[model samples]
Target: MTASYGSAEYQGYLRNDAVTIAEVLRLDGYRTLMSGKWHVGGSYKPRESDLWTPGDLAHPTPRQRGFDKFFGTLDGSGSFFFPHYIGEDDCQIAVETDDFYMTDAITDKAVDMIEESVADEKPFFLYLAYTAPHWPLHAKEEDIAKYQGMYRNGWDTLRTSRHEEMLGKNILEGNWEISPRDPTVHSWADEKNRDWEDSRMATYAAMVDCMDQGIGRVMAKLKQLGVDKDTLILFLSDNGGCAEFLAEEGWVESYPDISPEGKKIVQGNIPNLAPGSGKTFQSYEAPWSNVSNAPFRMHKSWVHEGGISTPLIAHWPNGIAQSAIVHTARHVSDIMPTILDVSGASYPKDFDGVGIQNLDGESMFGVFLNGHGEREQPIFWEHEGNCAMREGNWKLVREFGRDWELYNMAFDRTELHNLRDKDQNRAERMIKEYDAWAKKTGVVDWAVICAHPAMDWVKPAKPEI
Candidate 1:
């Protein structure tokens, strides 16, 4: 809901994007289940370690977020061996294992939830938001082993390979050109040695491979439960694969680094020393992050297509004739109405005695079923002041407090060309509309929005009784 691999434990500072969706679905009479990171809003203080201790889930959890059940951590990063989380009913599992990785555990629990939901013969709205490929670069030995030397080619090579594969798969068309590497990243040749680069990518690839396997497992469960064909599953990342500064937070390693011959080589997640764990902090760094986005201009936290444009794969045998038809018309907020359409549920004017905020998205059910769109609503995003608004083929995007640039999305999906001067009229109109919407939404200034300071402004005023 929020993003894959995001800390499920919502902190006090964040917003409950998931809760908003789940609550609306509940009004539709569907049982909701969420597994994975739910970084909505709550206490994520590291000192309060029980924040993730699974056995003692307190109030303001997924249940409060609209999920009937949840299994996830409060913090975004932690060790796999001593993974911490609170189960359903805020019951602290406090489960720790040398073998259990959080990604696998989250998926397994999701699968189990599906089984129970199916057995009960109730339609379930399941959100399996994963934390794969997130920071800390932790992975199981076997998963890590599978990726040994796989990233030796480094980000430069892997980025090229993924780009080519996506092309063959028609994930990309010939229309878009791959962007150059980010200037901030030191070129591979510029790096002092290859180990830091290779290990960083190796860990990341492991994260991706491990996530793919878990996804396959979840798909298997849906197929097993006889809902694979009917259930609508939309797979997407919250944002682009994160290239956040890893040095500051440190790597949360699950396994010690080993040589290709299976001998311990480098300590994992440690910063400045080797790219490794526990005491050491690390990230895949900037250059490779540029590669991760590929074809797109920037990594996460930026408003460019690379940072915001993600692959949206929708699968529903009963609803879609296109098995893997890629749709560029939808946005993250579109999910709310899409689910309602498929399930024939109605959004509540109010939930739990509280008036509801009007939804920012409309159902995309028609596009899936008719092979065309029924509606095209303006979509807006303002994460950390990297703001963007899309209305049909025209979009207004900008870095907060920076100049706003316009683009023709249909022709410029890669955003290589700017239409600021060429389409001043269109830009002005969209900017006007954006301003109006911002006012309507109680939009904060760029500085506050970017920092994500407490935005208690009412999206919808309280409804009269």
Candidate 2:
């Protein structure tokens, strides 16, 4: 429902009326299970009295929605070591071990859940929503050690190297060029505290590395269960690298003051003290995030390619004919329709006496089989006042309170060139299309959303929708 953190409209949670893919699968006789982050629901606390009631608008837990089993944190981001609001089914759980890492713990539960589902002799759908690679950048010592000093060459070199690697592997197609480095970022050679900067990226890499290892463990479990070939596994990130820094005043109040081991949590990007420890809370910050979204412009929250573009990898040994990179532009909404198409489930018009919203995305099953999919309508996106619309190769995008810029994504996916002035008619037509879509989707103006009384605590540099 496009809910922002601490917003009064949604109270930072998903609305209850929205039908989830898990619910549909459950109705189709699949044992739905989930582990890891569950940030869509109301804030879950350790206290039983604080739990959400049935009538609450933003309090539908995963179990309540459709999952037969659920285990994860209710909040979006938290300390990996001593998480703030962890839940198992309906109740909260405490961190029982000194060395308990959130990523590993999530993997453990996922493996266990798979075993239980298999033992019950029912087909299962496991949603392993790992909260790795998000802020407070925390990772295990071993994972951090592997990436130590790896980023000493800095983000600039990493960008060039990664872009070349992607091109060589044919992952990028059609005359795509890397966008220039963000102007606000300093050249690595001119930067002071190179060691600290390198450490930030290293810690971030370690978090991802740990998550990858956990994924491998899940794959191994699938193989052991003799369902590796039959099961369909899709992997994708929620968004691009985040550029948000944990430097806001009184930010520590949002998190636990102390760790589970009674250690005081040291917060913010302190230059001297490196990240990756339970006691420290830090973010990779913008400079490294620019590297994370290498060859693309901008970070998360923007409608730019860098913020919205992410690879959707599908692995189904039995279903897919061959491994190939598909350059089709697909939205996150398409995942549900694709799942339903693959599983032979029907999308109901009504569920539990409530009308279901019409699907905004088309099934991507054709793309999976033939590496191509057709869309009847253009894709539209609006996040934090940054709006964009894409129809075939043409794209119209604009930052808040700015003139629209156009690009032919076929030749300039990085959006380095602007065509709005050259093709005014096309730009105007796309703008009208975007406006119509926005109005139909009930998209509120950025200024109006930011001015709401609920956002008084938020002091953003720009209006956040």
Candidate 3:
């Protein structure tokens, strides 16, 4: 249901071991179902032959995690056309047809489950996680074609354009200036491989477009089942845009050759080998990713506002009011409490004789009714020592191994100004607060954790080619 980093090479396996919200809802008599990416468990090197043959169907799968039904892949990214680890419930599905695209297929399975739930006349909780717009950006050609020449102006213009649009639409809350283009990226006009670079962005957009189309189909089905008004639909991204410039040659050798149909699979960011095909594995890289997180700094993995920010869309006609953008900071942890509050489900003191951990989330269910609310506690983040804490409008943030920067987000949520030097008092208070939170949460030293034996995946920088 959630797209978690399952690889022990980064975060440890404990991420997948916790009780899921789906399991809790199931205990409340809701029929739990899930489709699409389940990257929280299992690990396997991708291979075309594994499509029909089935790869590592490891323990602690969706079924074990409490979903009654699940169908999807187990890895972070795979061929949308011919995925390597496709599964239906506990069984691995054979990829016999090249016509399959993950966005459509994942939706197809969800619709099937919805129909079954309707036939049984049971209220259901379905978790549909789409790994769209992720790396190894493989999208359908038709979808890709829709975006042809769409990014001709390149990331420079796109970033500024999107920032202006967000400001015009009031999607932004304050006078947050768009952060300058990442210095690492060159000007659009200076880029030599314009066509290839543009094509990569086009493909990435196609993936998002395809996912939107699938979501529309799912919504239509919900309406048809007379559940649209009552069913709560919340959409959110797992993280900000990914800026990890994964050179294909750096990792492609780990995958299996000879695709499912016995064709030699072409992989890498080869300039001539245009992406969007099943045989090719490619990433749009950081230029477009910088645009994706426009007006904000950094990308996924950092504690910058861009890395952790995503808009949450809540739709429930029966229980909530019309569309309204809420600016209150919310964390992913708030989701479970929100669902439980709306469903009138209680957080159990103990489950199956083991004591349950008390919830650390405040429900945003009130926001649905009133369009906005506030949390008493400050939101905190710590990923790989890239840490942040936001209390009201004041924000304290720092990249891994960098000095902390404080910002008064009331007038600058884009984090353009550093108030740490001017207001040392506020910075010290926030840092002290963050230290307490870190200690209470058992956050260990990053250096020690990174040095662990499990982190063997941290390879040295070398020319992959």
| Best-fitting candidate, scored by TM-score | 2
Task: List RMSD in Å for every model shown.
Answer: 7.8, 2.9, 3.3
Q: Write the per-residue lDDT of candidate 3 for residues 1-465, one digit (tens) a residue.
A: 121233333443223324578878889898999998877664445653344322223435787777899988766777777666778888887877658888888899999999999889988999999878887778988889999888989899999999999989999987578998877778898888888888899999999999999999999999999889999999999999986654555555556545767887676677757888877877776688899988998888887878988999888999887688889898998998999999988777766566766787799998998888998889888888789999988899998888999998878877888999999999999999999998887676667666666444433223322
Error of 1 at 200 (Å): 1.4
lDDT of 1 at 465: 19
Best-performing candidate as measured by lDDT: 2
- What is the TM-score of each predicted model, taking all chains together? 0.83, 0.94, 0.92
lDDT of 2 at 240: 88
Estimate the lDDT of model 1: 0.66
- The reply for model 1, stretches above 4 Å from the true place, is 1-19, 27-29, 50-59, 248-281, 448-465
lDDT of 2 by residue, 71-111 (tens): 88776778898886678998877778778899998999999
N/CA/C clash count, model 2: 0
- lDDT (CA) per prediction: 0.66, 0.82, 0.80
Clashes of each: 35, 0, 0
